[model samples]
Target: MTASTKPYLLRALYEWCLDNNQTPHIVVWVNEHTRVPAQYVRDNEIVLNIGQTASHNLSIDDEWVHFSARFSGVAHDIWIPVGHVISIFGRESGEGMGFEVEPYQPENTDTQADKPQAAADKPAEAAKPKKGLKLVK
Candidate 1:
């Protein structure tokens, strides 16, 4: 199997934004695999400022984009699956790329290799957002 090009493109665009002195932001599709401030999500999505000034310990890897940032004066650690990123664009120029949201699919594992014991023991449904909110068209 071949690796997806999405992560590479994301990194490239992020670097481009920084080179041009623009703030980079990402549109994230909130899902079970995403760990963000749920209270700030709108329409099941959140826009995150990923620029150096806004985020700390930022990492954009093949599978995840991890960072910590202040939201409403409180620090929050953000964990976003690369597949859930809808788009990344410059806040000033709005130049970047968008990708189709990919559904989270847990890899099948026997004995759950490499996964933390606690995480492996937790039920998948436990990570899901609570129901009650609905998007009105």
Candidate 2:
């Protein structure tokens, strides 16, 4: 089995943003398992700036991207599964790559994983936007 290219692309894009003197931002899909500042999420998605000035201890790995940052004077620990990342781009020009969002599957869960109909019904619900933060395209 080969490693997924998503993580590698994420790292490369982040570095490209830095090298170009642009702020790097990531758009993520928030779900029950995603650990993020809820107040900052809207439409089940959030755009985050991961520039050097915005985050600390930033790490982008095969499974997860973790970092610490302050929001409204309060520090927050952001943990996002790579599967939930929609895109990574520059805040200046919005130039970056978008990744396909893979359906989150728990390793040992037995909840509708085998049911295609149940899975098909989820998209409508997922399309509904929650109110709060604004999504950047």
Q: Which ten residues in a row have the lowest lDDT in candidate 1?
A: 128-137
**lDDT of model 1, residue 48:** 99
Q: Candidate 2 residues 1-137, lDDT tens each? A: 99999999999999999999999999999896467888999999999999999999898877778888999999877777788999999999989999999755555324334423322233332312344533232
Clashing pairs in 1: none
Model 2 residue 70 lDDT score:
98
Instruction: Please name the candidate that would achieve the greatest TM-score relative to the true structure.
Output: 1
> How close is every model to the real structure, measured as TM-score?
0.81, 0.77
What's the CA error at residue 84 for candidate 1, in Å? 0.5
Candidate 1 lDDT by residue in tens digits, 1-137: 99999989999999999999999999999976678888989999999999998999888877778888999999887878788999999999998899999865556433444343433433444333345533222
